[model samples]
Target chain A: MTLQMTVSPDFPPAYIAGWYIFNTWLQRQSGLPIHLTLYDSFAAQRAVLAQGGIDLIYANPYDAAFLVRECGFVTLAAPCNRADEVVLAGTQTGPVNTIEDLAAGTVIARTDDPDVNLMGMMLLEPAALHAGNTTAITVDSYPLVAKQLLQGHAGIGFFLEEAFDSLSALVRGQLRELVRSRISVIRHVLLAGPGVRAQQVEHLTTLLLAMDQDDRGQAVLESMNLSGWEAHSQEDTEFMIDLMDTLDTQVLPG
Target chain B: MDGYQTRIRYFDGHSRDALIREHEVPFPDGRLIVSRTDTCGIITHCNQAFVEMSGYPERELIGQPHSILRHPDMPRAAFQDLWETVQAGRKWHGHVKNLRKDGSCYWVLATVIPNVRHGRIAGYTSVRRKPARSRIHESIALYARLREAENP
Candidate 1:
């Protein structure tokens, strides 16, 4: 049977082709027939995941809890020096210069990426913008959230820090960031499902860790906008997953 | 062409005055319809599946703004969300009601992503597939409420 692989939908679209390239490289290196399937949404990806259809995944920290605890998946690796962060921003010309200036009727534009949304909401706490006070509109991507700010349709927006930084300089110039979450421990991870053999996991991990040392591997990493991969021990994985669970519970009721 | 022209008003970049038929064409499962548009949302390429589902020939689609297929029933907020998402260099997924050349409509689960070239977004690519019946129903109700809010 062919092994299946998927990446979290939160990754930038520019890396779509890069993921496919990495998949082909992995298949050749591991000698496993890995089929890469891309999903457009976390909900859609999780639907297949609930049925045990995915054997390998590059997932965000929020989903790591479900994958590791409920699905019997093991942490394989994480990108080096990359941590998930959230940025709360508004149009440079908007009245809200800071989070404290956010008002009751403020329209907060955000995406369905749970962790980023949660952190963004927490950042809004100082302004007393609760579920009852603010209007939240869910868009499909970070760029859309920024669009809401740019068009004066929304008073504020939530974005993944990486996504915000990736915005074109021209667009970024039009917005001012209110705050950014520095929860450096929460990072995306690569994992192997229960179906993956231990030997295969070890070999795959070895190849990934050495990716930055070779020229071709380095090029693939650059395409994905990654520096390199670092081996994630089970203990560190559990710690990060536990932190995500705690953060989930701490978010204000919406 | 007369039937199509009579039913839907062709505009340069906006189609807020298009007619709605209250009809929905069910998108076929396992078939993916694909199209590409320039940064300004003008059609650059469309696949055979897109042509069939849209009821427009390739010649008719090329050089037209993507809004040409915009159905009247689709809320402005939905398109705003789609535009914002793709403009940010990210992928956006949503259920869309599209108007065909014959003035009929179809519902598709659409995924649109920016086509980045040389560190800049040159255009966008939208790949659409069959939407779940349940999602279509939810979208209908949700879009109705959103449209009401917009006009109210």
Candidate 2:
């Protein structure tokens, strides 16, 4: 079966390269071929997966929810995510470290798609002041969010940790850490199409988990930031149902 | 377009195909594509992946100008600068935006080098692959913006 699927283009070559290495390891272990069709964003991937273009996917945590519920896919494995997710904020003076320090009516900046970004924040629990308090400004890109922050147009920028280092470092220094989300990222996830043989996925994921125990396997795992795999699909059922309940999207013309 | 007749080799004067097969990029996942030609533009050889990604039957590309895939939106100055750099026999690495046969665009992290061997200038060789998302987003958007400005 074609393992082709969509993935977030956020991380770049490192993210794609990691998949290449993992795919190679899996093939050597299971003797099966896997291919991927990567897209620029989770939103883009989700649209295609919904139409049945992908048999497997490498998705983020919140994105994984959409695929599970909306597309009827099953999650097989979660890769190691970065320790930090990301925060969006503009210039701030003095020490405003806690989430409580921020006042109401503060506008937290975000992208056009709230399904991934906002849902992730909900999972992480932003400052209560953020509830019914903050207004969201629709921006097209992260750089625009950065622009809003630099121009003092936005109060906070909620984004991924992989922001351009210059602005990322500045935010870390200048803004209050209103919400330091643990970024329960699914640095990588192994997924399968709806109604895929459970045993096939189970067998491959079992090989992925076993890689942590041996030496050569550890080399590939370490180079790839594999912290070992965990099984959690049944647990994801409710979130999946909830995700489809809320998010509506269209496929991007490729 | 007997660009191949104008032979020059930048490194060790080998044909483009030979260099590609042997040049193990230091980055294990890194890939390269090279070809030989004269000081003028003409294609002699191409690496395996080059043919695959360009989506062109190999024969269609070998005798054509490298600019065949130059999207109408690419900056002429980028090409001009690239030519200038390779002519100086210095290697340059940067991101490039190219169009596929079907007109879909993909960004490549590209490196271009001039062929210089035995005190004579030969042709040029380029290596490229899909770039990181951050770089792809920044580079493609910026290049297109620059191209529009140049045309305007």
What's the lDDT for residue A238 in model 1? 68
Name model 1 segments beyond 4 Å from true.
A250-254, B1-152
Compute the lDDT of residue A108 as modeled in candidate 2.
63
Q: Candidate 2 docking: what grade?
A: incorrect
Cα RMSD of all models vs. native, in order, equals: 20.0, 21.1
Q: Give interface RMSD, every candidate, in order.
A: 17.7, 20.6
Q: After superposition, how far is residue B70 of candidate 1 from its true place, in Å?
A: 62
Alpha-carbon deviation at B59 in model 2, angstroms: 74
lDDT of 2 by residue, A167-204 (tens): 45654565544443332322345677774577877887
Best by TM-score: 1
Candidate 2: misplaced stretches above 4 Å? A11-13, A80-88, A94-105, A112-116, A119-135, A138-144, A161-171, A182-188, A236-254, B1-152
Q: Write the per-residue lDDT of candidate 1 for residues A137-214, one digit (tens) a residue.
A: 999988898898899889999999989998989889999988776556679999999999999989899999998998
TM-score of 1: 0.60
